[model samples]
Target chain A: MNLEGLRVMGIDPGLTRCGLSVVQAGRGRAVLPVAVGVVRTPSGDDLALRLLRLSRAVGEWMDEYRPDVVAVERVFERGNVSTVMHTAHAVGVLILAAAERGVPVHMYTPSEVKKAVSGNGRADKKQMTAMITRILGLSEPPKPADAADALALAVCHCWRAPMLFRQRAGLIDGRVSAAKRRTPSPDNHDRSFPS
Target chain B: MNLEGLRVMGIDPGLTRCGLSVVQAGRGRAVLPVAVGVVRTPSGDDLALRLLRLSRAVGEWMDEYRPDVVAVERVFERGNVSTVMHTAHAVGVLILAAAERGVPVHMYTPSEVKKAVSGNGRADKKQMTAMITRILGLSEPPKPADAADALALAVCHCWRAPMLFRQRAGLIDGRVSAAKRRTPSPDNHDRSFPS
Candidate 1:
């Protein structure tokens, strides 16, 4: 897969404030920032309404940026259960927006993103902000940690895209060979792809 | 609010299998079943794809059944963290679908559903199924524990609608009067409703 000119949208999902960033891969290891912002929803709103607002915001970003791939921060079970659940909800809507537009999506854990951006799995917010500011050549650090996290997620995916693509390709090839052994028909090859 | 002929759709959100059921509130405490089924997505599919499929399935149900309100089982952070996160994802998309169609969404805990259906907060699956079968006057119990749970959720919402409506109305009235006291402008009345 060609990585040149590839655009990626990264999302840090949260019900109250979802962070979104769009980054384009330039020549070599250079990455250009396209957009970075947060989608805020009032906590007083109903859950359904809040989710709907979040979905529309993400959908608008997908339409405006037309990113080739979307990267989302994988939520974990730690911290407050209610907060985690809300974050998971935001993730669902964000991912669905990408799928609806037929854009490929990739998810990375917090540790993976931290390691990719700062070379440390346990890097704190300040370190992450500093690294991202230096990497992006921005005059000021990204404000509201969520925005910085989104940028980090996009950078992480841009760096890992080649490896992930190769891994998927390898899996597809293995599945195709296994299918050929079971049946000598071309139709069986389609089974390799998830429906 | 008139309870007669009110339609309610209950969703038991899950990634692999999402159960959906539609029930109409009849005279008094009688409730009639309109539809019952489960939407199944293969685990092999990507999370985004699965979520998109779930969202579509629920959206189709909402269009076909035209439910006045949607009731979803409130997911808790228990058991496997991954499973809970998936369930929360399902819940988010499901709620967004309802909100997109302007249908109000309500959530109930597992215990609330059980108590409403079987008068026992700790009612087991068998008891809940039996109670639902009897209450709906169905020839047979709804198959798949998810379907039965969906039906119970719908029935629970139907029974609780009157109280819930009253509570919401009271809250709105109180907010409106409080807003009037703060600023006697009529335009501020809109603030009482969630934007």
Candidate 2:
């Protein structure tokens, strides 16, 4: 699969502050940053109104950037239940927006994202920000952890898209081997990319 | 505030099966059933597609019924984590759809709905179905537990609307008394209405 010039949008979903970024895959092991920012909703606002605001912001980004694929961080049930619920809400809206626009959506777990970007599944926030800055050749680390995280997600998707495409192709062709048939399990560390 | 003729839509949000119902408030405790059904999405579909399908179904209902308010069953953290996450995602879409069309949305807990309908906060499903059928004057109990739950939610909101209105009024007027200011607590059973 040719990933060159493939545009990807990544979203770090949250009610209070959602990170948004667009990145394009370059020749090889190179990613070009297109856009990066955050969308925020006031905590005091009604949940419906907040969701509406976030939806509109994301819709506008989709319209403007028009990425080929959207990658979002999958919500996990490990944190505070209320916080997880809110994040899941944002994720739902994001996915709906992408699907409405007829764009394919992909979700990557946090560890998967960190492994793809920083070569360490347990990379800390500072490490992720540093790696993202280096990968995107940005002058400074993206402001707020959310913004950096979004960029990392996009980069991760860009790197993994080819492999994902191959995996899907194998499944569609009914040629999945024994190794591929096994549900992929997470490892303590991933070295697919150099740190 | 007069609630006569006020139409309310209740939603029991879930990914696989979402129950939807609309009811109109008549004079006093009289309630008229306007519409009732369930929207279903295949479990095998992708999460994005499932959410999109549910959102469109709910949007059509909102557009066709044009209810004055939407009452949704609030998502809690007590259930299976995965189920709760899926339910919350559906809830987010429902709330967004209502907000998009400028319809006000209110959420009630399962216990609150049970209490409002059966006068018992701990009423079982059979009791709730029986009470809902009696309250709505339906010849037969609504089929599918989800459908019955939806009707119960709408009826609960109808009965509690006046009190919620007064509570909001007190808050806006900044004259809430100590009793009014305290967060309302739920008791084991309520006998506001004869069962």
Best by lDDT: 2
TM per prediction: 0.87, 0.92
Interface C-alpha RMSD per candidate, 1 decimal: 0.7, 1.0
Candidate 1 residue pairs in backbone clash:
none
Off-target runs (Cα >4 Å) in candidate 2 are: A172-176, A179-195, B172-176, B179-191
Candidate 1, B39-70: lDDT as tens digits: 99998988989999999989999999999999
lDDT (10s digit) by residue, model 2, range A104-166: 999999999988888889999998998889888999989988989899999999888877776
Going through the candidates in order, their DockQ values are 0.69, 0.74
Looking at model 2 chain A, report the run of 10 residues with the lowest lDDT sum. A186-195
TM-score of 2: 0.92
**Model 1 lDDT, residue B111, Cα:** 94
What is the Cα-based lDDT of residue A3 in candidate 2? Answer: 86
Candidate 1, A3-122: lDDT as tens digits = 989999989889999989999987656778999999999999888889999999899999999999999999998898888889988888898999999999899999989877777789
Q: Superposing all C-alpha atoms, what RMSD in Å does each candidate have to the true structure?
A: 9.8, 3.3
